[model samples]
Target chain A: MASQHTRTVFFISDGTGITAETFGNAILAQFEFKPRHVRLPFIDTVDKAHQVVRQVNHVAEVEGRRPVVFTTLVNVEILQVIEDGCRGMLLDMFGTFVRPLEIELGMKSNHRVGRFSDVSKSKEYHDRIEAINFSLVHDDGQSNRDLDEADVILVGVSRSGKTPTSLYLAMQHGLKAANYPLIPEDFERQQLPSALVPHRKKIFGLTIQPERLSEIRNERRPNSRYASLDNCRMEVAEAEAMMRRAGIRWLSTTTKSIEEIATTILQEIRPERLEY
Target chain B: MASQHTRTVFFISDGTGITAETFGNAILAQFEFKPRHVRLPFIDTVDKAHQVVRQVNHVAEVEGRRPVVFTTLVNVEILQVIEDGCRGMLLDMFGTFVRPLEIELGMKSNHRVGRFSDVSKSKEYHDRIEAINFSLVHDDGQSNRDLDEADVILVGVSRSGKTPTSLYLAMQHGLKAANYPLIPEDFERQQLPSALVPHRKKIFGLTIQPERLSEIRNERRPNSRYASLDNCRMEVAEAEAMMRRAGIRWLSTTTKSIEEIATTILQEIRPERLEY
Candidate 1:
């Protein structure tokens, strides 16, 4: 159950306010009380920062409580304005880390406003978009002919976290990722799918604990034999053995987030993927 | 061409380091110079923070200059340790935002360690995973039968940014997003696809400038009607008219980033999507 007492939280950033809110929610989720509400006000300049401070002041006054502000303002002047004008706690992200970084790095931050995809016209943005389109068309082995263009091919049983991992690799790393499911027949034959044999070197296998797999499958098709723990155990065991025999590198997705899984895969393969 | 003058940068976060790096890179990209290198060290405690301070100190000494740090640590003890231990300037995220938040929030933050997806079994974490899987399986109209379960169905012509936007909504917002393409046949008929009739309330249309759509499609199928600007323009015009006549809400993907597009869709539909 949620707590009765709640606090208002604002995640203010000069950018998307995504980073501010991510850390803010992560912190608030740990408290005994839930936040009364949360607002993400993307404040990109001194003018906007002052507007946010006023909003924070208004919220504090109206709620009869002090409001919580989590901000990622990079400009010292803008930050100063908020800190000076606001009557609440200001958790400034750059203030906390930038100075220490400046001392450690022996350089001053350029203090540029948060950069977003306004660079959609740029090559980097297009490359990522291209990769996503490639991934979508190549998804679930739908376009086998284009498989040769993929930097990585992820193969595993249905619902072995292949799709999200593929998309993650595409979105974050700009890698063209194509995924194929190891159907029951492939497990029965105890072989990698024939379409993948030519590109064996690029294949990465994903495995999950049978029990967890069963739980996930049950969510999709409850009470089915496919979701049975025994069936999941057998299929996963067979898939692992097949990949092992083929000398394909594999990772267990049982306990890994998509980020961890994607990072490990990137490290293992080193596909000249985009780092950002 | 890459720049010659460069410096080392570190993205230190008690959590995933994703947000810190996103902001860090955004700021860095604006400069004429490039980072010599970047490091992401996920430090979770006062000890780890101190360790980071030492590493940054070592980098400064070895490089004959201080290192720039972009960080998102939430605890004061950890921040204090890093600030005191390091010989460099400290940019404390929480140091700036938390105090302002505390005054307004009227309560002390629980000071809990940042919990990332490594604590992988949380409900909120699983919701994102589930949504990703749902989106993947339902991607590009893969399973028409399950369309009833989708939070939103993104409809647009091929190469109009529907897939990536749908995937972004799923990955970032824990939204079960299914996308359908408006094929030439649908345009010829000047009507919504019959399968999408029942889900009219949940449909969101994505449109792009014919020039951009032609460019994107040309990358896939060069010198063809599919990639021809004339065809793209005609198809897009017809699709827009059809969607407009059907009262389907739509957005242009030409000028906006995926983040911008997803945010607008969320605001328009309010599909119970997760904010963080």
Candidate 2:
């Protein structure tokens, strides 16, 4: 238990410790050393803070080493109390993060309180985007569905994650998402899907870094018409032009995770569908 | 904005801020008065924390009132700095929540420094459960070609959100998810799916609060055998007993949102399948 190799991180939050856990996990993934995690959720009072501090002190004493603390608190005084009692390092989530946003929003110091509605609304929008995308892939061409059915509808050339993205959207957001592949033929023909044209407002085109596309294609078939870099560039450019001509909005899927891409699309387009 | 009636919350975290936003939104949903939310993700340094504090101050100025701050920080000293700078109420997310877990685990407090190996392991266990449930649903009397294709599977009495949950899983996880409904006839005959019985290790059952089920059923049918409280209870108990007999693990879905239910199941049954 008292090894020089392992460190313990206490991830605490005002409500559920999930936020700290999620973010902390991602950061930890970036590190080579793995440490232990202690998560505590739903702490809104000073008494709770004191109890937690005592625990931290006990752990430090047993381990014979000072530990770092990563925390999110809703009360300032409670944090002070913990700091006074606990000798180890501590991290405050809100104090370090929200101050700038408050300034940007033109609010006074410590003026912002409570949960932002935008976050939930953004989630809702993302859900809708996912639903739309899922519906496009799994449409089976049978049912005429509502807008809520979409997670995201990706319009782009071959090799984009349209199919996989649509599937991911459905699996992640419970959205009946779908996708439509935008082939070179479609670009040559200068036609968008007839079904999508009416919902042009909902359409979002995906463009990739042409080099990446070429590399991805080369894996499937080298030196072929489909895998040529010049062809990839031409197709991507032409697709962008077609989207611009059609007055459809679009995003670049290059150098982004599926989650990031989906989240950005949801935030920018179809934001109304979000519950928050 | 100067609205005295409203309260504001700032949700600050060291990473994506999604978790804080999620739980915060849940709490906010309980209030009729919608509070303004400001979120800062990826606060890895004390400098970033200072920047956030400035933002909170600005919001306070704009609102012309002191707002409550709800924060999740990784550095305790930074929390102190923000508290010193701000006049509004402060809520420290970590001090309030995770300190106890450190004691329970008998581990030292290491701030913003740990690996979530346990979480990942738990996620793997959850994924296995979901996988088995998915297998039972999508078996389809044909060849079970891809067991890895599942995101989750739900086994329970009919009308337990099995189909909807399967659809949600498929739509959300890109998982070729499936659901196996326990029919009344099957319950009366005291039988389990022969195929599922073989893969009992993967099975997960869903049971609902009888009253809740009755209310949900009452919406579809004013008066019917299917909607009766007595019948619902009997079916629930019998189904649970059958699962226990088969050594299949299960969860109750009563009063949980589909998102909450799905998330809990995914976390408990298929922790390994977590994308993050």
Candidate 3:
């Protein structure tokens, strides 16, 4: 008989799956054979839980391994489905983590904690949640129409942190921020997005050193057009030129984290539209 | 004949203004009045630097206050611009923060440490930077088509750690993780983006409780449509229904930080397209 396979641990959860993923990854990183991870977010139903079990079984079959499912499910019924279906280990989210909190607080089993319920009571926490919300909704080219609705707009070249910056703006500032990439094509055309041109006042650009861009690009597509030095330089230069001509204010996204970019943009743009 | 007024504080920097914002906000939070903020990100030129000064002046004029500018400019020359234009207190970003860092590292003035500049030759550090780049490009609805191009994709509701999760995925996992908001509209339509539907295998979902949603929403709009409990319940239910019918795999966005979400998504999704 085959040796009992090392358990394939699934850090499943109902939401972002980051917590289980982080603790799970940290634990896995310690081991030589990284136990497999199967995370299922937004699993708020019995059917979904059943589906997750099927997927777990499939992964186990493919790897010829018995897997331990670590999950954070909001609905209790789904947990039952997962426990019943899977033969390997199972870690239920609420049961292991949240239940203790409920017990400690003496709150009901289904006590929910989120921004709206807690905002009036906690300004700092609310601001962080708002910051996260603002960041998630704000995207550059795709969400340009929504740009006007943003508290800030982050403009940057590829890999210059248009996305994370946007997230930071949302997560930290409680400001709605949208980000748009100053793509090679957009630069070649020498035009800001038509929507952005009118709102140039709100536009903030992010550029990084060509060398930095090269290093970042090299990691993805080494020696390719997407990550080439010449291409990056051209894109950066053209993007800068376009920002200059369009009169859209901009910033450089070189060495900063998302938090830095978002805060800076919020400070600079100060969009009146964000007066919620 | 007006008495001297409080100065507006501007935190301008080359990259994201998180550190400056945090420190600045911490200091400001100690104060009772809302301090004016002018943050310029991605500052690579004298012109942009000049614009920031102009904005700072505008704020001062409007508020009838001399603003204290807490800035982090990458280029020293930009500092000169702020100094020339403003009469308020100025805290240079690099001068204040990096000075300590430089002293600690025994590095020269010219030795600038940036996200692109590898701090150490450690694989972990290198991976973190790569992860940040990946998250920057991967916005859910805006850049989901790029999902196939992404190292990972994050799915979640508003404030469910999608943005942070994406950033964490990029900053830690070196995986390009694009995120999309599972909005009420999308759920009401009972459809995922046409693009995401096909990439169901790669999609992840994040769901938080309605009460939590209400808590988050109430902060922005005290009693608006967004913050309504009924709306929250409806949206969460719809999003879950949509996710289930699409047969797209998902994760919850509740009770996790950006770090955990990113890591779990990376392990579970494990997209074929990785960034080097």
Candidate 4:
């Protein structure tokens, strides 16, 4: 179902190309068109660069127009090969910024192929791995052994999008996130879970629209009362009321992506811990 | 504990600022210096822009040097406010490329506060959530109910980095990834687990150095035979031999980040499927 105005977009990088995609996506968001994304990663050699240029040219020929290519390639010779061969609107993501940065800092660019920090042996890398392990062990109230060590605790009703958000916080931000589900029993008592009370300052709540919650729960456990819209509505109401009573900061996940939810939670609960 | 040569770097955006950080980190890696990273997200208003400028200037004054600020703010007025007020070397992430993009595309930019796609209701968003749920349910050979649906299946020995990589593949790439541990039983039996045989074409292997694997396992089960270096070496050796016999593509996770491993796997097994 290709549209008449569909344009091909290529993300090229000498390393993982994730940075190229992230940067290119943000820039492409301003335009109103469908993009067919193609990622060419690990393009460090001139041979690969020439092959990439040929592929881009092929795509341009088939589409009857030049593709928009974005590259984070650091090697000048390899980048020059692509620049000389490709027939597209090429954006040099690194050259555009690295040149200015070098001049501003009065230093020479390292011109390395992979520009990611040497994190394999860094303390920050180990901390991120530990955070990932912690979040997994603490996922869905699986463990309370290290509850006190959690950077943030998330409480929400089942199917309200807690586990994914918890994992995202840990994986992306190096934060130890633990999540607990707010069940009917807790709602009957009308209090924050006892295990979470001591860590109340680090607690955040997530709520989703009842309709969406029901839809999600139905996929997990169909034809059950727990998946009924009425049940979802009642549970959501109780959870919201409980959060309000406990003075917990909460946001609706109905319209927010996992990135948005995690970012918003960090801003509210741990603004100072926002560094990666 | 700041180094004398430490410089402050700020990532500001109207959205999560993840893109700004990702792009900035790549560029910063070219230089050799410690950076004090700061992130300011959700800066959609002029007032927040003013506040950020003040903060950047204050950092420049305290450090006795100008801070390097990276911004993905899309609003012209807010961007102008920061450009006029800040004393730091401001790198307008969006404005630097958007102007030329506008001319190339023959259209005016949307200039929206948040540049992220409208993923709240898109099928892509739902697919990502589904992928996350699928990965969790199938993690570590937890279930084989939907093994056929997985886009990639990972096999490795215990503590060789399966669960985190599986979860990352699902979260970041929207791929349904399932991981299974290659235990002594499988090695002795000289075959993969029965459940993974049918999905052989989609199978990938992860191996780690025995010493590193022992260190990781020791943290979980201290002084146990399973965490001993001798046992780790045997398991790793047998696993590698089995993978070579089974003709499954494999990589070492000893010195690679999750991003590097995941990207390599995608490039090897599913290059055509690498799209957001």
For all predictions, the C-alpha RMSD in Å is: 4.5, 9.3, 14.3, 2.0
TM-score for each predicted model, relative to the true structure: 0.82, 0.58, 0.44, 0.95
Per-residue lDDT over B13-119 for candidate 4, one digit per residue giving the tens place of the 0 to 100 score: 98899899889988998887668889999898899999998889888888888999999988888889999999999999999889998898889888865644566
Better of 3 and 4 by lDDT: 4
- Each candidate's DockQ score against the native complex? 0.32, 0.11, 0.07, 0.62
After superposition of all CA atoms, the RMSD between model 1 and the true structure is: 4.5
Interface RMSD of each: 4.3, 9.9, 12.9, 2.3
Model 4: residues with Cα > 4 Å off, grouped in runs: A1-5, A115-119, B1-5, B115-118
Per-residue CA lDDT of candidate 3, range A130-215, in tens? 55555655565665455566666777787776765665456545566777777766766778766666677767888888888888
Residue range B1-276, candidate 3, lDDT tens digits: 123333456666655543445444433432344444545456667888778777777776776756666565555676788789875556553464344433432444552323334333456555655555556655555664456766556666665556666665665456666778887667666788666665677677777778877877786689998889998888888887887887766666555554344545555677321111
By DockQ, who's the top model here?
Answer: 4
Q: What TM-score does candidate 2 get on C-alpha atoms?
A: 0.58
- Residues A184-256 of candidate 2 have per-residue lDDT tens digits of 6777788886666666766677788899789768866999988999999999988888889998877776655
Model 4 native-contact share:
0.64
DockQ of model 1, rounded to 2 decimals = 0.32
lDDT per residue for candidate 2 within B50-129, as digits (tens), equals 88778778877887777666565656777777778875677665555456535643654566522222322354433433
Greater-TM-score candidate between 1 and 2: 1
TM-score (C-alpha) between model 1 and the true structure: 0.82
Full-model lDDT, candidate 1: 0.75
Model 1 chain A lowest lDDT segment of ten: A267-276
Chain A vs. native, model 4, TM-score: 0.94
User: Which candidate number would show the highest TM-score if scored against the true structure?
Assistant: 4
All candidates in order of lDDT, best leading = 4, 1, 2, 3
